[model samples]
Target: MPCRDLPPPPPPAHLRGWLDEAVVRADRARFLSDLGRRSLGVGRLLLLWAVAAVFVLGWSFIGMAWMAFEQHDPFGYVYGLILAVLGAGVLIPAGFWVARGARRDRQVRHLLHAWGESDRDPVADARVRAPGRSLTWLVTSLVLGAFGLWVAFAAAVSARPGDTTYGEVAYTMGIGQILWITGLLGLAKAAAHYRWAVRTFRAPAP
Candidate 1:
């Protein structure tokens, strides 16, 4: 008689159920892991933006102070100096905070990547957490951008060529430009995060 071939048997019932459960758990873990990674990425971007804002604003104020002093405008010089001091105050603390956060983020990212590659469950891991909706960030960005635009427009409208030097106009415009650009970028990031969250974390139907 010719040799007969038989199909392999399916998994045992209990084993099949357990296997399906494992798959579900693993899928959830991977989702959480990816979410955590994205959150960290946003955080890093915000931190970088903070550094840039501090650097640009601080220098802008200092440059304005110098220009105003050269022009012998007492009010402008004093105003500029006050702003410069305020900028320095913010920059000092922000610098340290950003550096620490950057280091921590790098460490967390490494851990999450390793956990994912190893098929470890990120849900069980406390380090993995979901990000917020980012509404606050979005609103703040819009407000700052609006305020900057208003300031820039007002400065441009009020200053006459005879009364204002090129340096004065340039410095005044620079502050507003920096603020609006930073705010616009922040708004984009916040909106992106919000959209991602909405898409990824849809509510389950009752």
Candidate 2:
């Protein structure tokens, strides 16, 4: 007899529904895994940007303090020192907080990847279904918003005629704008997380 290609046996009818359900679950796990990866990347980038901003702006504040002291201006020195201290207090902790978040995200991504690889693993399935929240994002948003408010206040106080240099006014306003924008970005990320959680983990109504 000539060599022939044998037709594959069909799955039993009773098992079809179960197979389909398994496939659906696997697909959902894959989707969540991909979302987690993308979110991780975005979170890391935003956090790194915040850290960079902290160092740059923090140094600028110190430089301003030195200039004020050299110019024999008590008010200027006080203002600069206050801002420098505030920036150090807030931004340093914020940086570390964000860094910790990035590490957690990394671990979550790894777990998600492993879950994707072994779609039938019950442990992986449970891990995938667990809800998570990022405290770092929340804290960072609040911190940045607070800093923005302080900068705005400084700008207003420094705007009095003949009381401040043009550079000082411009710098304060510019930093304020940047801080507000970054803060809004953090809020946006938090909103994204909320939406994802609601969509993915919400219980179905009867």
Q: How close is candidate 2 to the true structure, as a TM-score?
A: 0.48
Candidate 1, superposed: residue stretches over 4 Å from native: 1-49, 65-133, 203-206
Which lDDT tens digits does candidate 1 get at residues 109-143?
44444433433343444434344435556776788
How many residue pairs clash in all the candidates, one count each? 0, 0
Worst 10 residues of 2 by lDDT: 1-10
Candidate number of the best lDDT: 1
Q: Which parts of model 2 have CA positions greater than 4 angstroms off?
A: 1-24, 40-132
Clashing pairs in 2: none
* Top candidate (TM-score): 1
Judge candidate 1 against the unseen true structure and give its global Cα lDDT, from 0 to 1. 0.59
**Residue-level lDDT tens digits of model 2 in 1-206:** 10232222233457657777666565646555454535534445465465648755764665465556546577877886786686577657766876775665555544444334433445444444333434566677778877886896779776877777655666676677667666776667666655544454445469
Every model: Cα RMSD to truth: 14.3, 13.4
Q: lDDT scores for all predictions?
A: 0.59, 0.58
